[model samples]
Target: MFGEYRTLSAKPGYSYTYTDGWTLSANPVYSYTYTDGWVYHGRSRYSCESVIRIILAETSLRSTVQREDALNNKIRAAKKLADIDSNSSQLRQLKQLEKELEKLKKTRADQVRTLYEWECMLRVGSLRRGYISVKSNPAWYLREELVEDCISRGGCCSRDCGCCERRRLSAKNGKGIGHCTLECMCCIHDQGSEFTAEEKKDFNGRFGKMLRSNNPAFLLRITNAYFSKPLFWKIKTKHK
Candidate 1:
C-alpha cells in the first residue's frame, strides 16, 4: 500500500488515501493537500476573481475620468468664445480706448516737435549775434526811425528837425527832406547820429552797386532784412 501511495502521489492527476489511527484523508493531485493525514488544504477559484475584477474596475474608472475631462475642456473653450462674442459693447469701448490713446500719443509728439523748433530758432538767433558788440532787440529795432521812416515817410534830411510823431506832423508841409534827412531826423530827435562825409560817399557807392546788380529778389531780401540800416552795420562784426 505504501508503494502504491508513493506511485499515485508522483502521477500527474491521481488521488490517494492516507490512514492514521482510523482517520482517512483524501489528497487531490490537482487541487488538494493532506498533511500528516489530518489537515486538508485546497484553494477556491473565486480567490483570484476578486483581484481581476478590481483591476478591471480601476481601468474602467480611469477611462471614464479621462473622457469627462476632455468633454469639460471643450465646453470651457466654447463658453469663453461665446462670452467674448456676447460683449459687443465692451469690445467697441476697447477699440475706442485704443484710438484715444493713439491720438494722445500723436498730440504729445507734435507738442514736443513744436517746442524743439522754437528752441532751435532761439539758439540760431543767439549764435548769429553772439560775437557782435552791438545787439538790437527786435521790438526796439522795429520802432527805430531808420526802419520806420524808410517804410512810412520815405526819408528825412533836415539838420534840426525831430523825427518823433509831433515833429513829423509839424514838418509835413516843409520842403523836401534832405539827402541825409533820415539821419538828421534821428539826430534832431536825440535818437541817432550823423554819418561822416566819407561814410556817406561809401554808402552811396555800395548802394548804387547793389541797385545796378538788377537782381530783383536780392534787393528785396536786403531791404526786408537790413531795411535802411547800413549794409555793413547790420552784418555781425567780430569784436574779439
Candidate 2:
C-alpha cells in the first residue's frame, strides 16, 4: 500500500477520491481507513508510496525551529526528546551508517511490542529504507511531491541546480545514491549551514508529528511506510 506520487492539494479541506470511489477529505486530524480490506499484511516497515524519508524528515533549510523545547520539557518523556540528535545526518555518509542501522533494527524489533499504538504516541526515528534500496538513482527516490515538500521547506530541491537529482553519495563504485540529506553539500553551500543537532531533532520531530497527526493521506503514507504490524483502524477526519 505504498503511496503514489500525486500533487497533494493543500487548499482547505483537501479530498481524496480513490479509484474505488471512496471520497476522503484530508484534514490534519484526518485518518486512514482499512476500506474493504484493501490493505497490505505481514509487513513491518515501508509504504508502497516510497519517495525517500530523508526529505520528509530533514526538512527544508528554511525551517524555523519552534520553541517546542519548553513544551516537550513538560512531557514525562521530554528527556528522550532532549537526548535525540537526529541520526539522519549520519545516514548521508553512506558507509558510516551500516553498523549503526543494523543495531537500530535489532533494538526496534524489541520495542515494537504494540507497534501502531506506540508509534502514534511517539515516533522518534524514521523509516529511511524505502521498499527497495536501489542504490543511487535519483529517479528511484525522486517523488516530486517529496521534492516539493523539500522545496517548500527551502531545501536544495528548491534550487535550479538539480542537486537533488544528482548522484553524489557513492557514485564511483556504481552505488552512488542521490537525494538531499541534512548535510547535502549544495544545501550547505547555498544556505551556508547544516542542521544543528537540536535543529535536526526539531526537523525530524516535525515529520514525526505528521506521522502522529490525523492527516489521512499523511497517516496512510506513514502507516504504509512504517507499518509495524499493529492493529490498524479507521480515523475519521471529515468535517461537518
Candidate 3:
C-alpha cells in the first residue's frame, strides 16, 4: 500500500511530508525523524554493505573537495604573489602549483569516472548481488541527501532557521564549529525528552503511542562516528 503512493520529487532543504506539511529543515542532522514509513525494507546485512560503499564514496568526495579547494587557494596565492613580486620563491611556487594543478586535473577525471562506475554498479548490483543502490537505499540516501541539501541551501542554518546562528560560537571558543554539534546534540536530546502536553496528546491521539525504538545496536553504530574524535590525536601520535 505504501509503495502504491506516487513518488514525488522533493527540493533541496525540503523534505516531503505525508500530507502537504513542510518540515522545518531537510538536514537529517536537524530533522527529528524520518524513516521510509514504507513497508519495504532492506536486509540489515545488505544495508550495512550498502552503507559502507556509500561511506567510501562520500569519503572520496570529501577528500577530493578539500584537496581541490587547497589547490585553488595555492593557485590564487601564487597568482597574487606573481603580480606583486616575481621573486625566485614565488616563481618556484607558481611552477610547482602549475604541476600540481595538472596532477589534480587528472585526479579529478579519474575520481569522476570511478564515481560514475560506482553509481552504475549500485543501480544494477542490487538485483544481481541483492545490494541496494543509493537511490533504493532510502535510509542511507536520506542522510547523504540531507548533508548535500544543507550545504547547497546556503551552507548555513542562518537562512533556514530564525536563530541566525553562525559557524563560530565565540571568539574565545577553541572548538571551531562546535556550536553546530552542540545544536544537533540538544535538538536530538530534546526530541528524546518530553514535548509539551498538547504535543504529546496530539501525537498520542494520532499514532496512539509514543515514538521509541528498541534497537540499541543501531543507536551505538550511528553515534560511533562521533566517538572517534578523542582518539584522533592519539592515533596520529602513534602513527608518527
Per residue, candidate 2 scores C-alpha lDDT tens digits across 1-240 of: 133323333221222334335755321211233232122322222232232233232222112111111122233243343357435443344323344445544543333333323324332223322222321232443443345456666766667776555444333232223345554556666876656889877777876666544444655543432322111222211110
Candidate 2 residue 7 Cα shift, in angstroms, is 15
What local lDDT does model 3 show for residue 193?
A: 47
For each candidate in turn, the TM-score is 0.20, 0.38, 0.39
- What is the C-alpha lDDT profile of model 3 across 153-204, one tens digit per residue? 3333323531213222321121112212212322324346434658635643
Give the candidates in order of TM-score, highest first. Answer: 3, 2, 1
What Cα-based lDDT does every candidate model obtain?
0.32, 0.38, 0.35
Cα displacement (Å) at residue 183, model 3: 24
Candidate maximizing lDDT: 2
Off by over 4 Å in 3: 1-47, 123-240
RMSD per model, one decimal: 56.7, 16.1, 18.8
Query: Is 1 or 2 the stronger prediction by lDDT?
Result: 2
Superposed by TM-score, candidate 3 places the C-alpha of residue 114 at a distance from the truth, in angstroms, of 1.4
Q: Which regions of candidate 1 are displaced past 4 Å?
A: 1-164, 172-182, 188-193, 218-240
